[model samples]
Target: MDYLDNVARNFTKKYPCYLIPNQSEDKIKAFLTDRVKT
Candidate 1:
């Protein structure tokens, strides 16, 4: 969980225009899947 927290922190720092709330499991999975595809 700490790793994920750090990743979120860095992501937010790099992309301040975006917001990542406590989304649903499916949304998180989809987001990760899209990232992996790229």
Candidate 2:
């Protein structure tokens, strides 16, 4: 449960767009990675 909760929190914080699907992990990863590049 803790692991799941942490992932949930991280996902939401990193991708606050509620309209996006949670299954889009790759998209989120790319978004965050791009953010780090700047």
Candidate 3:
């Protein structure tokens, strides 16, 4: 969970403009999936 927290923190810092007002589970899942792939 801490790893994910750091990842999310860096992601938001790097791409603040990419955020959405209503983030969904599916979107979070997809982001994690994509991150895992790389």
Q: Which number leads on TM-score?
A: 3
- TM per prediction: 0.49, 0.45, 0.52
Cα lDDT of candidate 2 equals: 0.62
In the range 1-38, model 3's lDDT, one tens digit per residue, is 66766766667667666465456333554687688989
lDDT of each: 0.56, 0.62, 0.63
- Relative to the true structure, candidate 2 reaches a TM of 0.45
User: Better model by TM-score, 1 or 3?
Assistant: 3
Model 1 pairs whose backbones collide? none
TM-score of 3: 0.52
Q: Model 2: which ten-residue window has the lowest total lDDT?
A: 1-10
How many angstroms is residue 28 displaced in model 3 relative to the true structure, after the best TM-score fit?
4.7
Query: Model 2, range 1-29, lDDT digits (tens) per residue?
Result: 45444565588777578327755655655
Per-residue C-alpha lDDT of model 1 across residues 1-38, encoded as one tens digit per residue: 45555565666667655555554333445565577679
RMSD of 2: 5.6
Ranking, TM-score, top scorer first: 3, 1, 2
Q: Which parts of model 2 are misplaced by more than 4 Å?
A: 1-9, 12-23
